[model samples]
Target: MSQTRSDLRTIQPSARIALLSDIHGTSSDLDLSRLRARRLQQAIEAINGECPDAVLVAGDLTENGDREDLAGIRTRLDLLNAPWYAVPGNHDVGPKAGIADDQPTSIGTAAYEEVMGPSCYTATVGPVRITGLNTSLLGSGLPEESAQWRTVERDAEPLPGPFRILLLHYPLFADHEREEAGSYWSLDPEPRQRLMAAILRADHHLIVSGHLHRPFVREWRGRALIGAPAIAFGLPPNDRSVGWMRLTVGGDGRVTAEERPLAVADEVR
Candidate 1:
């Protein structure tokens, strides 16, 4: 029997995971309603057409803790047709941040969990252990949330696998300065440095994040750390449109992704 083009392609293991991050209420931004649908359909088609097993929303699933924002994210993501998981971003919380919310602040965990299910948790797929870290604890004015990284790092016990991938909203290591981390709502050097050390010490294969909103791919020694472009809106210092990533996690555990802008008419060839 001659195999169809799709059939000839290897379905990424039931262990494969589709990652999404930093959506931040872009669900209704401009023509994003249609673009979002198409981007998601492309991803689903990649998963179903190539047939991956699961999808994971890394973080920043909403712009704010607005019910409408969160609900919209959940609805679009539900179309993936597989067991899905998510972590929370700074915007997922109502506002108070590091503290629990009572009046629905904007950057707290409780608000995110209300819609996304849980702010921080773990899901295992095949021999892989995907740990979703909540870096949003370190919000716009809060560095104390950096402590949460300790909890996740400490609780990240040894996993009996060839790869351990940590997914989060903020990049622990970024192309930013120590004094600049606070301004950008990113992890300070100490927290980020420690987190990177912990991940490396634990022998993780990859660490992925999206809060930076810029797209970058770099490898330390041989390990890869990816910064994904936000699907909601592109980052500052540039005029690019919104984009999403297609990550191919290899069997030998090398990770690669291409950030494709959504509103552009020129497609990936």
Candidate 2:
């Protein structure tokens, strides 16, 4: 018989996932790129030391989604002892049209897929069911948008897992679920509501995201929403700690997250 939500809670804890984001890796040999590479290496080593069951990269794996850069980032990530999954951030897939920026045009979905597999995917890791989404396409009116929506809808159906984790590049909202959209840092309003509704249907217990370059944890509708720290660098006006998140789901379906900061000594100028 398929397990019910209540049954899942009683299952023994069985998963440890390392969450990292905003790697900002690049193929360039510039100083900033070199620093980011070093930080990424340190972060990977830290994660390995934790001996996680799996790794989830929230997005921005590359500085600009350059094929070479993405390839290089992938090579580094492969060093992790655990299998890893990732979604795409704005930097990896390009922002929606009309956004102002000095960055190059979108790398286009095909190129990104060539390196990162798929922009959206669902995987089972131990007792958790993880669904990764591409927030950049949330409201971009692109052909892939419809397909992704179907995936979201599919995810809403109950699945047999002690925990369900929704992973994405952008947080559904910064402060409150009712917050306004059009902010460069978050998903637009319309898609946000739809996505939340679907998550509610599935009763997802946790939502993990990275993009703000800051780390925070908030509870909404009894679900934990976590903003993971950036692995490449820090942004001001926030935690700004360059590191990663260690998330553990216990047997009782309780989720705990710890921030693992990269040693200051490892950060070289």
Candidate 3:
């Protein structure tokens, strides 16, 4: 459905952005270091060459919130000609699976803020207003989840902009427009409904996220759901497209996004 060209420079862009996700920069198992680092480095170099206005990372900057891993990824991101921003993914600060339903999360929220700034925030890139959400708190029962939702409700209000883009790690639905809340691919029932309602209430044009590690796009009502593929690895036949999404927002609020494959020689870990 996309009329794509070979490079970003070929298009006349008022403001260009590179959206990257799921780099999974480090592994506790030392054996996988070279593989992960090589792919991430390639993606970073590719983004720098594009000379976009900004680079937005959808999350999973590291494997399991490793301080060293976050440091490595942040160092490489510093090389980009443009500023880079991000939100947290499940991998970066998600609570462990066995935590009780009523308990708070001992996840890496502090580390994330200390290492990557706020887990959620808003920024305007030219004509586009980007609102980032930390979906890692979906079912965690953490008090931060409630506070975040309140903040998001406030932040998602319509602003004077051409595009109101929302960035989160998880998709509202893993499969289709009508899917139920508790699908294995997205947030649980309560948070799912709450988040969906919030987005629909807001004046939003698009939603971009990364977590499934696969590239897919869908449209519901008037908004577009754009997903980015993983850079560190792929999910076999489903996620063969290892790349980032490039977007161009014009002065009139018109926006277009295209997927650009990475320049790495290897496609799998």
TM-score for every candidate vs. truth? 0.74, 0.90, 0.85
lDDT of 2 by residue, 75-190 (tens): 99999999899998888888744466555333456688998788888888777788998888887777888878888888788665558889999899977777675687788789
Top model by lDDT, which number?
2
Best-performing candidate as measured by TM-score: 2
User: Residue by residue across 13-45, what tens digits does model 3's lDDT show?
Assistant: 267888889888775766467777777777778
> C-alpha displacement of 241 in model 1, angstroms?
4.0
Candidate 1: stretches off by over 4 Å: 1-15, 26-48, 94-107, 138-151, 176-181, 260-269
The digit string of per-residue lDDT tens for model 1 on 114-160 reads: 76765666667765667776775544244535545655677556554
lDDT of each: 0.60, 0.81, 0.72
Off by over 4 Å in 2: 1-8, 101-107, 237-240, 265-269
Question: Model 3: which ten-residue window has the lowest total lDDT?
Answer: 3-12
Error of 3 at 35 (Å): 2.0
lDDT agreement of model 3 with the native? 0.72
